[model samples]
Target chain A: MNVIVCVKQIPDPALPGALDGATNTLKRDGKLILDDSDAYGVEMALQLVDAAGGGEVSIISMAPNGETAGMRTALAMGAAKGILVSDPALQGSDALTTAKVLAAAAQRLGGADLIIAATESSDGYTGTVPEQMAEVLGLPSVTFAKKVKIDGGVLKADRQTEEGYDEVECALPALISVTAGVVEPRYPSFKGIMAAKSKPVEEVTASDLGVTPAGWAGAGQKVMLVAQAEARQAGEIVEDDGESFGKIVAFLENLKVI
Target chain B: MAINSVWVFAQVTNGAATTGTLELLTKARSLSPNVTAVLGGDASGVAAQLGEFGATKVYATGDLAGKLPGVAVAGAMKAIIDGGDKPDLILFPQNYEGRDVLARLSVKLNKSVLTNSIDVAVDGDSVNATTPIFGGNTLVTTTFTGEGPYLVAFRPKSFAAEASGGAPAAIAAASVPDLGATGGAKVTAVHVEESTGPKLDEANIVVSGGRGLGEADKYAMIEELAKLLKGAPGASRAIVDAGWVPYSYQVGQTGKVVKPSVYIAAGISGATQHMVGMKGAKNIIAINKDKEAPIFGIADLGIVGDVHKVLPKLIEALKGR
Candidate 1:
């Protein structure tokens, strides 16, 4: 079955992430890499398409600056092509607008039998985009999938929950948001990296997709204010005085947790 | 800000409202007097208790027994809103089921969802939510720019839950829509992982282990201590990835967000990824050999000792006590 995976380019989370003070948005002017979370989707999509025998995996991403660096990494992992929606108007777009644009890009790619995405972006963590995309595309969504399988064109998964897991079944052309470590992501090989350069990445804009980036369509959630979250003050730090064992029990009892 | 009505998605489990639902209902009381609870399944058993938390009315949908909540409950709520029974503000608990319903409703109604809200305020005709972003580095107050029936999901323990000593609320039934393809995502089977003691999320005191534990065998100590305290056991991504524990026991950014009364970390160096999930706990105790470990930076009690040596003595002492 053909697949379209939505990946994101997020600032390297290992270092630091800053918000544009003037715009109240995540600063996107630095180096970016494929969000580690999305790697599972990209990998899962490639494996599914390969298991399906000869179907292709395409990618759709919405980022400013035509961020092809992250897209190329996915292509190296075996996605056939990519559609990057990069426009100044699309900047600061909330999860809804991002989903709309990606939905449009899915149509531009002639749609797909399966659409995969990480449960949420590491940067935003809204956990709403993939479901919104499924709604916009009018397809069923099975999110937080821990294990996925295909049988007779049916997309089945073991969806994760608070207590346990639910084995869910849906049709093709459905959307599935996978949790991390669903499968061990494979790194791009030397040959795959070289071929990724020639792999085409078509760029598009909101207007081209027949969607406007103004008023409600631009950003439905307006940022009223952005400030540093009050840092959690470190509590009493006592060196383990052999008496520490007794101290811990008293702490739990004092809190009435024991 | 005289609000017309406020609604809360009161999640019901085992014929009763979840604690998180009660918390949302309690907070909704401060927002408006006309607090309605939108529940799934038979809320008749707990409708009276909902009133104690300030719900004036309960709208429980029918026949969602075996269907996925996202498809059944969300479809029902969409129908209710479309019928012009919309409220000014809708509160959702930031959780698996809550996220599913909120996202589906957001798309169905063409509205925006403000997530991970720590606090919510109403002004004139708008509702604003303060959410911490960038992994708790900063806070951003967000408000919807579009039409009403605004959606906001509160993080766990974001608000206090208390009874207002009110009478039982009236119960009404909502017709569950014929969830055709929407309910196509049917759960075929449920596999409950073998776990001991209380659930990590529901536990009042949580004890978590990290990579500092040399191997998987040492995790027994973490569980032992948790069992002693009548708490729950949790693990960081390092051990979970190393195949020491199941993903359900993992606590971090992508895993469960727990805010137990006290969180104890054994051998964890406190990576930021792990910090974001448990930092909200009321009291944090870190046990690591490294005094400069990042976990100690935010820990309420830092025990600069080896987990191997400290946990044994701690467990032995607790067993005797």
Candidate 2:
């Protein structure tokens, strides 16, 4: 069995002012780490390989050349090999174009028994790429899966639903999008970190996968405008005192709380 | 081209329709007179209700067992695309299932999709959508430049449901294709964690406790207040990390995002991540000892007092009501 996991490098959303002051876009400063949700996908892929007892796991990512750091981190997690589809022209491509590039890479890699990805990227939170990739690759896809298991060459998993959950079973050569609760991603061990340096990482250009700049990125969709984000104003704070407490009661009553 | 028709996916669960489905139909009705509501599952009775929400035609697709909603939605989208009469736009609710289906359908159609849209308007041969970003701290207006159907998923509870007051329309049963992998993955079993508080994501009112509660046991006070108002219980990342509450109850950038009718913060200092989750709430009330707590910045009402004393009083006031 062969498993392929698609990972993305995203900025840490916890930090403040990580936005580019000029473009009002997210600034990819600090360390570019593998998306937290994608880590679970990689972990699930590794688990599947382990369950099969001696299979291969490959990690693929489409990012700028500098994003090799994220691919290295995935390699350190236990993937057999890594592939980076990097080019300077791929910057600012929307989800549709990104899916096209990933689909092309998957085809070039000869496809896999199973493909996994994060439910959504933290930066854009679009949550569209994996499903789009499935569509482009002409494969069935499932999103927000909590647990995945394989049996008799068939893939069975539980995906989180709004009200409850739905059980889905698909044949091999499918795509699955996982969320955080699916599995606790493993931290790279000292041995794994050292071994990652020796692991083979293949670098391929977008053209190598038959992705044309005009069709893939140049014809990409564009957002005509982005409205400015408004800041909320401070509210009136009432001190806790006998008189103020009475006023608070009155306020709640006016708001129909009391 | 003159706008002719619009389609909205009406989500149904346990024989009942969701509010977001009705809201989508209402919005779609504003765009074109030939509005259709597509519903899946054994919930075909919802087709008539779609007419009350201004759907001129209700397309009822019966349930396909073991098929996940993603497959069903994609099939429905294909039906609209191949149904001989094409629609100008397709609308879906921005819930978990809707988001998943729209993402897949957009890819299948090779079209651009706008999720979590707050508003939609039609211009000459184009449509504009508005959505909040950076956790509702900022809003962005975007438009697509393609000629295909523009897919949009609107946020739940964002639009008010309007009455159509018309007779039921003729229901059209759409043939749901047996696209393999409806249930792409099967669940052998399910184990739900025992929980008492309201689900933070689905709650209309939320009362959150923070580290200012001082001790893990003191959370009982916050829970007590939440119960009185029949609201959901939430916590800041600090308290969750400290083991006072489960991570599922945490409200922040890393946690659940809720836009309830009213949000109450008790003893929280209001970190940016925490604020981003609940900032879209209609009304915000904060109770903290420090007057300068950042939670007060976005709060509509603030009380400077010890949570230990304030929470109990608030409960009493709610009980008195």
Candidate 3:
């Protein structure tokens, strides 16, 4: 019941984000932090492994500058170790390329009953990499899982849909993408943080996994131009004056929604 | 290299073509007269309707038999393409099933994909896609530099779905190929959450609440007001992430993208991500106490007020009417 969770170390999303002028991709050279979205996956994996009673959770991430700060956060939260794939050639890689690298790294780790990831990263938000990784690894994928459970070597997931939810099932050696709020992520304890500083984190390159990254040059897709989106004009602003609700009623009446 | 055929991954719900599928079909027809619909479920029920929307042929897998449609459908399309019946372009909706199929297909074909696009343009032999990034504040134009068939996933409501009044499309049988270990996942059961009123995405009017509502109990005001207006209640990512509501009620970049006739944001100081989902509404009304809230930038009418005071009064006024 060894579980591997895919985590992403991204630039802090609280501040404004900028695109690199040279590569036309989001600038990533800044200090990276753990994407809040991936915390759910790490938490879910930890709980599942704990429930299974005899397994370990490992973190796998691909970030530039050999970033380990984000991975260390997950390690402090109780993951056994981590594998970081960082290489200059990996910059500007598309979603599929990232999927290939991650899938190859998962195979390199080997012997995992399950692999988990966030439905999408907060910064990049491609929302396609997990399923693509499933395709590349030739594994079954159950995405948008709000609830997951293990029963007799089978994985049962409550997959969120537009209407409601579908109970999906698959065997081991599968990938699952979890939605946010699926589980509560625990804060790293002081003892855990001290232990994480000495934990093992293997650093590798894309080539180390036998992956030739289809970077911006080979991805077959290019960002031609980036421009500001059209701005919508501001309308009237009125003080509440204890009667602002009347204006809304009049506005909706004008639109016939009343 | 010449544009000739365009294919759409037509999604069906309740034995009928989805509105998103019809929108893709309409856009595909404009790109090429030879529009084909690739349906994973029983296409017999919606083949004619697909044709009326401009599909000349429907390459359909009769039934998936409970297997995950993404694996089998992607396998079937890969087989069809391997059989040398490839189209120049393919369109899919940026949704669960669509993303699943397109991602699998991209890996199977070793092709690239452009997703979350809001518009597509044709220039000579190339197709360009426009995607809004940074929470719809910035637009990025992208195009494939490799061979066809190019894959692109567009957001729902990106285009208007209009029927061309054409004849029934010819149905072609497409069998799901052997999926190996990837076909292990299956839907065991479905549980539809009990929800009242119109769907958030399809409703003519939408009322959304945010963190300004103070706590979970106050969300009832949003629901009550929405009910009085005969609309759907929505929530910002903040509230949804805080466990105040289900993700289905979320309206944001990572959630549902809704384009309603009138959108009301109460106690919502709009984050750019939240604005991305509801900016397309024909009319936007923002009710927040903070006059400098970013949501007022695009709001059709900005009311400076408190939700606790204003929401109750608004609900009373609407109920009286």
Residue range A11-86, candidate 2, lDDT tens digits: 6655553445554455675677787668888999999999998778888888765577887788899998877888
Residue pairs whose backbone atoms clash in candidate 1: A113-A173
Residues B1-321 of candidate 2: C-alpha lDDT, one tens digit per residue: 446888887887556678778878778888888888766664457656777888877776676555566667677768757878677788988766787678777866768787767898887866888877676766776666657578887766557789686557567777666566433543444445556666787787898999899999999887887787778899996777566776568786656678887888999988765886788788888988998888888888888888887777667766776
For candidate 3, write residues A1-258 as lDDT tens digits: 799999999999877789999888999989999999999999999999999999899989999999999999999999999899999998888898999999988988884899999989988888999999999999998999999999999999999987899999998889999999999899999998999999999999988999987776878798988999988999999989999999999999999878
Best by DockQ: 3
Model 3, stretches more than 4 Å misplaced? none
Question: For residue B55, what is the lDDT in candidate 3?
Answer: 99
lDDT of 2 at B278: 85
Total clashing pairs for each candidate: 1, 13, 0
Q: Whose DockQ is higher: candidate 1's or candidate 3's?
A: 3
User: Cα miss at B266, model 3 (Å)?
Assistant: 1.6
Ranking by DockQ: 3, 1, 2
Q: Report the Cα lDDT for residue B229, model 2.
A: 71
Candidate 2 is graded, for docking, as acceptable
Candidate achieving higher TM-score, 1 or 3: 3
Docking quality (DockQ) for each candidate: 0.59, 0.44, 0.81
User: Each model's TM-score?
Assistant: 0.93, 0.85, 0.98
